[model samples]
Target: MRFANQTATFGVAALLAAQPAMADVTPQQVWDDLDAYLQSFGYEVSATESMAGDTLTVSDLSLRLAIPDANGGLSMAMEQMTFTDTGDGSVRVDLPQSIPISVDVAPEDEESMQMVIDHGLEGFSMLVSGSPGDMTYDYEATRMTLALGSLTVDGEDIPRSAARATLSAGPVDGETQVTVTGEQRHIVQTASLGELAYDIFGRDPEVDGDSENSGMFKGSMSGFAIESDSTVPMGLDTSDMPALLEAGFSVSGRMSYDASESQFSGTEDGKATTGESSSEGGSFEFALSPDGVRYATSAQALNISMTTPEFPFPLSAEMDEMGLSFSAPLSKSDEPQDFSLGLTLAGFTTSDMIWNIFDPGQVLPRDPATIALDLTGKATPYIDFLDPEQVETLEGGDTKPGELNALTLENLQVKAVGAEITGSGAFTFDNSDLETFDGMPAPSGAIDLTVAGANGLIDRLVEMGFIPEEQAMGTRMMMSMFGVPGSEPDTMTSKIEVRENGQVFANGQRIK
Candidate 1:
């Protein structure tokens, strides 16, 4: 899988570099620039170039890249590509209808594998504007498709029916702008697709030809779009991520879709099972740089349903919204670096059939559940994770990689079953005094918490036999020791604190 991903990345880079530029740019200059760009990434590029009138034709274009650690490599070939001067300070690009790619990967001390893929395009058009150093490309296509042609393992061809995969997208439009300044190249891209779909199937070759031995998956997405910006160093090596970051490489992007759905069917434990899932909308964002990395995703109006031989009834679930976000530093630093994390799952509910398994009498409230958290903190790292050598040293288990300096809980909430809990807190850790906490950093801070309908929820739990009366009594006693009764019935509030000297307290009373 890693080798395949590397091959794809190289293929994309080659295609992007081949895009022509306009405004007094000659066909020969465009070809030269393409060659230089691919060579910058250590790809062996070769092609036959010819000129006729205002058109420049490149035939038998090939790109080959060798993987460093793995004793393997990949190669891609395209039949023909053309760049024609339009006489109006713009160039029109003509791409082949089909492209074939081949990849060979051999992991250390493992059997070798090879893959063949075919890419197709229909009704595609592209126009390039601006100079070679600063270019703009506008492209559109009616449809595009990718299909797995063949696979071979250990020099033996695998049966075509054993594995199959295909992906298709239609009515796509996009634009790319590239600007070069001194040692840096800045790229900005925006694209959108009316719809996208995929299909995959697999069967165990060792198993007899039976429907039960095969599995299939299909999915589709609508109104998909993406926007991205990146800053890359000139003549940069794609490998050696640590060096890439040191050379000032960074990228950020966002992808979104209006709707999506998927379905899967297979046999599990000799029993048939099937499942389907759908979502109204979703979006994802990511960024990477020398300083840190950031990622976030959100979805809305999600629903899932499934059936299996083990279950007598179909199961289903629904969620109104789900979201998650995380960001942290990767570089080594003596001083603390900023970090954050957040998660939210709101309006989550399950089918009554599932609820009945645990709450048959429906003694507990069936209201949708909600859980949320938001946190921020600062930490110091002793080694740069992106550096392979440093990673190996840290992985030896003799060194501590980092230490937490501070943390702040901006918000936390959990609501369900006729009860709700909320809290907020902040803390600073004394990394120099791990002995005070028995090998853990000493922390000093305070947290304020509130609970609503706790007593009523406890009573319902006891009545439903989920908990014994003795346990309920012990729980209430523990709450009373730390919390004060609120004005509202069944509500309680509490304050928990840790002093600089490692003393613990509840409200104004010292506990340790």
Candidate 2:
């Protein structure tokens, strides 16, 4: 969400840079033009301007925008904004502080209740130096905070309460470059929000409907930070993607959310709540470019515990690590691009109470459980995903989404429930004959999969009364029809293939 806001900010700054430069212009005029430019894009700007020698100050400047079909608006307001001529074809910009922001939404029906939110900051200030084409800024604040200001229904306020956030980001810095053409501009920009720490709580609200039964929620995190960079054409419609295709510019970013400590808790009606969760720390990374997009995320030492009045004991579980990563091409072209994805989980364990409820004899392993897949595929898009008209054509079924030329499985593995499974395969598709596969791409290839200790696992389930005798017999018959016994005891293997004649085969026998 922060990344999205930064992208919009860059677009706004670029629009301002494209305006007439200072030569004979006053700082007040610069801000006026900026305000007007923002208005063209559905934003309302309010401010009071004053000039002191060569320094110009804009007080209580606010930028607001209302949501469509909603009876509410969002705004960001500053207390003192100043611009000083540096006498070198540049200006120094300063924001002494910011006022608390308020957001309220009231349904047109006049009966639906809503929340009012307010955010504030302390020791807020910015020092920026730049000319019309290029600008740089460094910002600092002692702390940033937010709260639920109130709750209202039918224009009447109700008693409400919320906990403050212990949020702090030491400092932030950024730079933006604007290239003005006849009437359009190209922009490149980057920004970084330093390490962030937050601890927030949601106190029990004073509501008429449920005064006797209420709950409170609390959460916290530390050592999270984000940085981003992007380049794109400004003042041009991106829906058609003409500018994107011509410029080939893209947005990319890196973030580190490796919080040192994180936790959450809740209570309801003087009893432990039904919803509770916690995590020691986690990290996430993301990036986007013309060639492709990618993301990598992981969390560590996670646990969740919950209960209900109907259950005899609370359910609790823990895991040491969880991770995921994926990458895919962003554009369509004659040449093939690479794509892959993977997931992993380790050191999973459950509480003794949970184990006693089922596997009292401890038939299952107390070790980690894991499942992972890695695949590489090449695709040639029949329609540009970024093009509005082409997208509409595909959405309307006037064309296929794309063509999958080739696919190969690098790895496939799973180890859980007293069994291990693994497989790999390769395939080529026939996009010209989608009808043969019921509107799906036709493929011709083979895949091999093997399961170890399957028979033993089935026997254990039957012994534990998890599967009835009739069901177990049916399962065995189905497996025998499609699988061959492996050399290893209790192991089974199956071979699946798609034939060129549009037929499917299992265990060397035609099934379709």
Candidate 3:
């Protein structure tokens, strides 16, 4: 994998650097710029270089990665590579059939360990073309494969393992734009995997000198696809708080998984258990920015079933559909930033074997359930989250300034179990006088809430022996004073308010 990554990075860098103001640029110039760029990022790059007409050949290409506390570094090499100038402001990259990679860790030890890997690909190529300010590259791999060559301990091979994976990403597209007089770089990249499959089979990975192994497990996922697109600020001084805030980078992507199947069986303590899970497709989306972040996920259908001799019944559960959405603000400002979250589950039925023991008669509503909330507030951070010194200040006293301008419950909703509840409210705080509320800032506002089917729910609970008759009677008596009956049947409404003078009221009547 590291070999594949380095190969891709070098190939892309060469092509990107080749984009010139005109089509008269030479191939050698591109490699020169690439070498300089890699050097700036702490990478040692070397290759056998040659030029033939409009083509440049870089054979035996090798790269050494940089690490903090290691005498020896990770390195990889390719047998042969080529970069050709199309003479029309375009460049093409050609790669070899295989690349070898090796890693050495704990080099200080006399008997250090090492691992070797080999990556194989078929029909791997990239084409780069565009103007100077904006460059685009398109690459494709018809078939991609990987193998773990060997892992040696004290310069000796351990128990040989059999593991491999084959992947296919038809084509990937990337675009880079330079702005702010080349001070800032904006990049958008997208790629996808299709018909991706992998399998693993390892037995008794050398437990002791004599090799007494404990357990073994093997599983595989098939018929799933993943696609992603992201946009972010690259090569920025993240330590500079103000510069980071100004950049305000963001990324958004979606993944769609089709009908997929996965199964696993494991043995432990001389016992074997098997579990299988499947999905009928789903989609998830997420986005992040300096100001806020948002995410949404939904699933069409999912099922998990397991069979074991230790259990009397085959345990299984499933959901027809599920959805969730959330958003949070990440900025600090005097004005409040709005935040909201919501969730919904539909047709969430369970297997009969499990439900029969809990609710045989179906006392609960099997319908869809939903909950949502929205809030607006201001947070005063006493220290910069990126400042090392300021972060240390957070260790003492209050992490944030004891200041809140306002808080508003813009919306609140919950609908489940044959009942519905909804409310909304807003409040302003008095930071000038915190003593009035015992060191907490005084707040004044009113919240209007309404509940439907409350009376029916109470009646059902009493009939089910969950609530005693005496207790139900006391609850009804208490509701008679504070709850205002709505026009709808079994419905009630209440208006709760708090005054700056520390007074509490319900339904226009003073409660405290």
Candidate 4:
């Protein structure tokens, strides 16, 4: 029970009493010990001072780490951070920052991270300890929870919540096992679809134990309730009311595991009740590493019927599967993992899916669509290694930009909307800007893919305005497209080729 309380859940309130290690060690020794500990983790510590016998202050402390690029490349620099410890087991670490910070992760590589604003701390706090294995740190709102309207994660807007955590340090075997558990309660506006989270979804339906242990870290938890009904945010030119009838509404069950990685498993076992009609249930699960790697999967069984507010026909999405996975930044020499997904809209009985795709703008080119998705594909970057900036930040005075590194990606693929595509590639970002360092364009890279899809894509594109009605009539054009639309069932075969060189081709003929 030594750590039983903090282990129960997030918001656990408990502080470690004075450590027995302090018995023979003076505060100065504690400061030195602490400083040394941080140094092992790549931190730069300048001073360790003891005040009034028990108080200690460590100044000029900082740390640096490297993050991934869009292509899974590493930055040539390290991320920078500073911290101040009050010596009372409480510490305030400055936010992670960049030297001439670009505010973009893999600034030179990723394509989907469009908004690109990044670099900063959400928040964190932890109890300081020694014996190497006995330590605890809790971070409740790292950037991950901001998907909701709360301006941060879970759509909850509050300064970061706290999570109490620790590792078994003083075991007789000198074991180094760590464990953490926590939660954050955030308020969300019903208007934003992002306002809800699994943390707020379903209650285990029954929770019983010491009232004091409820919500404490390392404790067992049961019976929880997370239910919410909200609308997706309305974009420019889009009617606010339509989202209430068109957006995705869901509920889920969640589970967590903490080992070498922090993983979460949640089944869509909830519902996606679209528009006025709600689905019976859906489920999803995933494992995410602090370093940014991810693994996930989800499926849903939907049945809905509505008439009053919106949506033209009653719908039923009897079966569907969505799979996704991605590995974090690749060190100069790390291997790449594929990120891909598969979705099947069987019983396409719902006019909603068709409506969503054809009228994706939801504000323009309103057209009709009816199609089935049986596609597969893959995604991986052209490179994965640190750029010079990243290297500088991570070295933190110990190493320099010239240090040697490596990065590699094997293969990545995905399928859906009637297309199957695959590709592989890699690149490196060294300290020299090519302009001064060596002479080259930002260590460029590339990926090439072969795709073939169901013929339905062309007519759908014409209907969706992606292609002209005339273009849809040509068999040669369909063969050259990246993929065919799903609206025309008779058109079920086409081959498409795409490459970093920027060209679309079918049978070696350029079409775009």
Task: Report model 4's TM-score to 2 decimal places.
Answer: 0.29
User: Which has the greatest TM-score?
Assistant: 1
State which candidate, 2 or 4, has the greater lDDT. 2
The parts of candidate 4 lying over 4 Å away from their true place are 1-284, 288-291, 304-318, 330-348, 351-471, 474-512
Report the Cα lDDT for candidate 4.
Answer: 0.31
Q: Estimate the overall C-alpha local distance difference test score of candidate 2.
A: 0.63
Pairs that collide in candidate 1 are none
Q: Arrange candidates by TM-score, highest first: which order?
A: 1, 2, 3, 4
lDDT of 1 by residue, 247-311 (tens): 88787889899999999988743577899999999999988888888999999999999998889
Expressed as tens digits, the lDDT of each residue in 53-130 for candidate 4 is 344444433332223223221111223323344454433333332212111233453233211112222332223333
The candidate maximizing lDDT is 1
lDDT tens per residue, model 3, 1-512 = 12223433534322342233343434565455445444433456888999998899988788776443444556778776776888776677776767776767665556666777666667666665555434555666665555567776667665555222233333323333222224443444444445445554444454433333333333333344443333323355333443454565445556666665666665554455677777677777776556666788877677778877687888886767777887765554555555556665655555666755655676656555556666666544333444456667767876763266677777787776677899988777787777877888888888999988777777767776778999999988787777799998888898989898878889999988
Q: lDDT values of the candidates?
A: 0.82, 0.63, 0.60, 0.31
Screening candidate 2 with a backbone cut-off below 3 angstroms (N, C-alpha, C), the clashing residue pairs are none
Clash count (model 3, backbone only): 0
Give the 10-residue window scoring lowest on summed lDDT in candidate 1. 13-22
Name the TM-score of candidate 3. Answer: 0.73
lDDT of 3 at 291: 64
